[model samples]
Target: MKKVRKILCCVFATVLMLSACVDEEIPNRNTPLGNFEALWQLMDQHYCFFDYKQKELGIDWNEIHDRYYKRITPYMNNEQLFEVLCAMLGELKDGHVNLGASFNYGRNWSFWEDYPENYHDSIARSYLGHDYYIASSLKYKILDDNVGYVRVESFSDAIGDGNISDMLTKLAICRGLIIDVRNNGGGQLTYAHKLASHFTNEKQHVGYVYHKTGKGHNDFSPMKSEYIEPAKGVRWQKKVVILTNRKCYSATNDFVKCMHTFPNVTLMGDKTGGGSGMPFTQEIPNGWSVRFSAVVFLDKDYQQIEFGIEPDITVMMNKADVLKGKDTLIEKARDFFKD
Candidate 1:
């Protein structure tokens, strides 16, 4: 029920499809001012976070336009103008936003960079050892303590109910479950939704999604409530802990949001990397493509999660534990189950 596809990917695909049709003449994307105007207008009309950013980040679209517009001149080189345009887009502090060129790509990745990295690959690998079960992108095993450990790196790969049910049956006897999704930059929303469905046997309210309706920053369609129907396959019955970090963004963030609503599900670790905006793609006059968030996804109550979500239990990885090749979060979760 919660959104499965990231907004940007959906919109970008649609825009690419429409652009493929020969109904409209291709816009002149050769001049600096033309590209600048096109990018500026694209964000001005379709970018969904302006209103929220204005209140939260103190961004004024008009002022940003005025500043970036001055940098764009007919005589300016593409490299120089691209730098200015990228800078203009960077103020949003969004990871889903990017400007692509043949030689370079411009993006705002401060979402994860500005936060503490709570995951260590070596440490996690040590826990998985040499014989971990692989179910698509899901790496799982029953820990020595009889705790179910499942590490999901990304949701890009497709998985079915049969696979999920088989995994659940394998770990069925565990006292508890730990789902580690740290550093997962996200993939498909469907995977997130499907994985979350197993934790509940009833329909669960997840969040809301709204699309831009008009050019106005606040012009949006009515918010729609999203639900996650319970899985038809085997579901977990015991306490479950979802591990998170700043790198758990996009679909992973949505998965965390849905899991937070399940009874006995505890979200542990650092804040999530949020990318709740649906993105749309447009091109500049120079053939450079600009992608931005065009759809807004809200929490069940209509609150914004564009930045990220806080975990229920804020646990940072212990450095002393890492030296021992242990994930502090997983160990802590094991203790929780034993208790």
Candidate 2:
């Protein structure tokens, strides 16, 4: 755990230093055109996925600037400028890209909004019942079939190692474990790594990360290998099923990526809502902050995970099952343990 912590710290520090060093000079003007130029230049120089998005979503950043530039008028109000800027950022179709202002948060959620949501809170709660044990943000209980069920709603809160160790110890008697991260929209990356560390027995190379090096869209540092060391405490060795949905994003997306590397772990349900890029924020001339993906993370196969990860066994929520007061994904996971 200490080694993993150290490595993560180093990675983050390096990214921060690199970002500081390559800082571009944008004029600090409060006019609408001035703010627009600053925001566009900021994203043009720092945003990591321009090339990938160009290929995947046909997003030409240069062309976007010209098109949105025409929409920005010197006489426009703050709200109108905000709308135009938000629309420009939306061209990338990235969930991590957001424009934060005092009045509103501008974002693109097409990543999950366009897909089938394979989760239901009411049905999921029914599976946990009213007697589930709460360990920090984790809700867990043993099922009638001797299977263990763990529900992780979000990673917004930090979870202690002791909490995880005790949870695993309690579920040790179960034949298999179901870790449902269905609507987890992500929080701390460390928590995602912490939970995934308990599933592996050895240090494993999970992926690679690339941080920007210069002002160019393609100016990325050489891909650096990322590894996950096994947890020092109690670990789950039996079959583990990870239930995912379109709402699984950011750190949750990272958790799914890490868990995908374990041989005993199976990803089930809809594809994850990918926000694989590490986000960094810079203030525009208008006092509004612009947050964009500054670092890129790729899987071990060197494939881009910024869009999302496909499940090994794709399972959609069954309307029939929901009508009967059951979660299809949980039922599927339980049935998998029986096999």
Candidate 3:
């Protein structure tokens, strides 16, 4: 299976947790520099990239210390110094980017709770129907005549088998599949790629990522190419209708990038919320972990979709249509299969 070239929401939040601290004492002014130094050293020592050496960034510790001293010598506290550090790091412009900060970390679905109005409103059914069954405990399903609709709620779940198994069973009888990912955010890019493989029978390269070298003007180099191959024992030899909205982000966006390689895929509904990139995280002292983007992704056609990815067939829901129980998005996809 190939990578989807997008990260998941949990992975992003987990990246933040890597640099986060909680229920801990604040460090002294001398400690911030030490913390930053330790973090930099740690990343150089353990980072997964092929080139994680300081020489790659063209900076020595002595020079970095001098630069920091000249820039923030007037600051009175570690907090102020840390702010400068954050600004310096943001220059990486990569996914999984972060700074050491206080954060609450746990295994709860906080995204849904924080944005209940977005998921529970009338749009939920249009995206994920109220009666949709979670078949195989992974993929979701709903019937729209000959078209079978499935809404992948998330990529990885601690309690379920995930979407791949569910999709295998449900897609067998349908003329076409409507994969709704309006607010999926993201999960594991590997899973996103695996799920996308079922829809594509031929081998194809999905996309590529370019990481920042941290040198001020150095151009990024290619990482590895993600690709897709056919899935054995679970073949969906039918048209794939992907339903997206502005909230479909990260690994979900990668799902879209991979689907474009196939001839059977068609995108419908609203544009996808684009947060496509490769993420990385490092643990700092005092249980604080910071994460950030280490790379940027380009689609197979070499387009960088950062803000959003538009639908092949655009459709938006209106208030009147909602009141009348008319799901224009689903109707549009259903009409496609009917034709």
Among these predictions, the greatest lDDT belongs to 2
Which of the two candidates, 1 or 3, achieves a greater TM-score against the reference? Answer: 1
TM-score of 3: 0.65
| Higher-ranked by lDDT: 1 or 2 | 2
Model 3 CA deviation exceeding 4 Å by range: 1-100, 103-123, 126-132, 158-166, 212-219, 283-287
lDDT of 1 by residue, 1-339 (tens): 236567777888999988865663435767887788788888888899998999999999999999888888889876888788899999989988899998789999999998779999988887888898988888999989899999999999997888889899999999899999999999888988999999998999989998999989999999888999999999888999999999998888899988988888998899999999867898777788889988888888777888899998889999898888778887887888888
Task: Compose the digit string of candidate 3's lDDT tens values, residues 1-339.
Answer: 134334566687789988865653323224556565665555443333323324344545445555654555543465665666665554333233456566432122222233312222465455455656665325466575867777676665432224465655765788888887767878888777777777766788887777665543244565668678777546677888887776677788888878877888898877776666566666666456766445676687777765457788887765575677766677778889988
lDDT, model 3, position 178 = 83
Worst 10 residues of 2 by lDDT: 18-27
Badly placed stretches (over 4 Å) of model 2 are 1-24
Which one wins by TM-score: 2 or 3? 2
Worst 10 residues of 3 by lDDT: 105-114
TM-score of candidate 2 to 2 decimals: 0.92
lDDT of each: 0.88, 0.92, 0.63
Pairs with backbone N, CA or C atoms under 3 Å apart (clashes), candidate 2 = none
lDDT (C-alpha) at residue 127 in model 1: 83
Q: Write the per-residue lDDT of candidate 2 for residues 64-172, one digit (tens) a residue.
A: 9999999999999999999999999999888899999999999999988898888888888987899999989999999999999999999989888889999999999
TM-score of each: 0.90, 0.92, 0.65
